[model samples]
Target: MYALGLDTTSSALTLGISNFDQINRYQTWDLGRDISIYLHQYLEAFLAPLSWSELEWLVVAQGPGSFTGTRIGVVTARTLAQQLHIPLYGISTLTAQAYAYACSLSKVNEGELIAVEYPGQRGSVYGSLFTWDASNQTLSTYKPLQYIDLKGWQQLLSTEEIHHHLSPDTVEPKGICQAMIALAHQQWQAGQQPTWQDILPYYGSLAASPPSC
Candidate 1:
């Protein structure tokens, strides 16, 4: 994949470089609101030994996450992809969490469902359902991302018979940079090439309204 991946959808910032082979490196920082201040410097130093020109692809977590953090990441990634003239793959934060967990499983049932959710504003939740195919290291979204009340989320999970329910509080969203990179690599290997313009940060009714422009 020879790609650089980023995840800044929370209080932390994560960066990773990978080849989907032997070469893999990653770092995470709990910068909170100070992330924007140190982001450029961290990225520059993290690129180490290899310059931006050497990266063949770019990957980032396009979130259903913190409003400000998600926008910052997507904008930075989009700009880099545009300037580097490389394909950019924006992975869903929910999918990355599911992907990471799924990778650790020893086996899967015939129709296993992995549900991931993050607490949204006002007791609502941002969630998605994913089915991971271990054979090809690919993840398919069984239920698309949505914002719903906790009661609705519980009903959906019970109705769908989800086998695994994951949350950021347990797995830590900042640690999924490698998963984002891996998912992007799988898609790229499958002959998928997404442009930077096609990527956008997902903010699902933050504060029950659209984020300020």
Candidate 2:
């Protein structure tokens, strides 16, 4: 099965294509412009060497990232999924990042994993904690934090037995895409392929402590 994953959660645009267990291609661009414009251009360029008809699924990093970026990615994924009549799966960006980190630290003896993403205007970050199970190739969410205090990093550390860290700084598109593809394949095998509407991005609770520019 062929799966395509897209992540436009940050200033960078990341795209990945995988066939079953192998990643065929992956790309990341730091396009310092509107996401929609850059995304379209990037997709067009990337898709030129491949045939969309060969794709069986589309995976997207459902937000908790940039609000505008999330919208652009979801909208694009929805449109493409509809046009292609393929299954669409939404993976939490934070979750994917955590998974990526876990894979990188597969040799580590013990520790908790944390994934974080900038929430743009929210003033706080959206993060999630995960316990890595290397043998099962699973990273289970220990706790989900929609808004976290940046200054309380030490406090956050105390809340969990995190001997290791996997923040956004360490995550890469290749890892995110691989996780998305693995998830999509698992869902497909389980006959749980989701519809387009169900693949929409998730923006965490909208409550606010007004953002500081």
Candidate 3:
């Protein structure tokens, strides 16, 4: 089965294409402000030689990253998945990061929670807690993705904090597409049959809602 994964949650534009057994191609570009403007051009160029009809699954990073970028990425993924009649899987941006970090570790315990964090607007930061599942070599949601102030973030690291069990780790946007693809494959193996309508952006705020096309 062929699959494509996209991640535009950060300043970087990440793309990954894979067959069930191997990753065909993956790339990351520092697009900064031009992500939405050039996403299609880059995607088209990357997919120029690929058979669209053979693409069976579409995976995307539903985010706690750039609001506009996340919207564009999710909307694009939804539209394409609907048009192609392929299963669409939405992976959490933070969870993808945590998975990447865990994959880097030589050893990870089954219940070890990893806090993936990134800066947010003002003095806040986007944080999500995910537990490393040793058996599957993937991550499970430990705490729902959230936006917390710097104080809350610091407190989260305190011994008495609710998420104190979670060990903090950082993940850069570079090479994240591969991790997203891996998580998508894991979800597919687990029999997750998601539709285009099931894809949504997670902006890590109470007032934020999933983008509607």
**TM-score of each candidate structure, all chains considered together:** 0.91, 0.83, 0.86
lDDT of candidate 2 over 1-213, digit per residue (tens): 678888887777888887756447888888745777778878878876678998888988786667788778888999999999998888877777777666777574444555454543436566666677767677666666456656554467677777566666676667776776666666688798787877666665563321110
Better of 2 and 3 by lDDT: 3
Report how far off residue 160 is in candidate 1 (Å): 2.1
Off by over 4 Å in 3: 160-169, 172-174, 206-213
Model 2 Cα shift for residue 166 (angstroms): 2.8
Model 1's lDDT to the true fold? 0.82
Q: Say which candidate scores most in TM-score.
A: 1
lDDT of 3 at 197: 89
**lDDT of each model, Cα atoms only?**
0.82, 0.71, 0.76
What is residue 45's positional error in candidate 2, in angstroms? 2.7
The lowest-lDDT stretch of 10 consecutive residues in candidate 2 is 204-213
Model 3, residue 24: C-alpha shift (Å): 2.9
lDDT of 1 by residue, 1-213 (tens): 379999899999999998768888888889999988999999999998888899999998888787899999999999999999999998888888887777766675445898889898888998888886777666788888888999899888888877888878656554588788877877787899889988888888543332111
Pairs of residues clashing in candidate 1: none
- Position 25, candidate 3: lDDT: 86
Q: How many backbone collisions does model 2 have?
A: 0
Name the runs in model 2 displaced over 4 angstroms.
21-23, 110-122, 148-157, 207-213
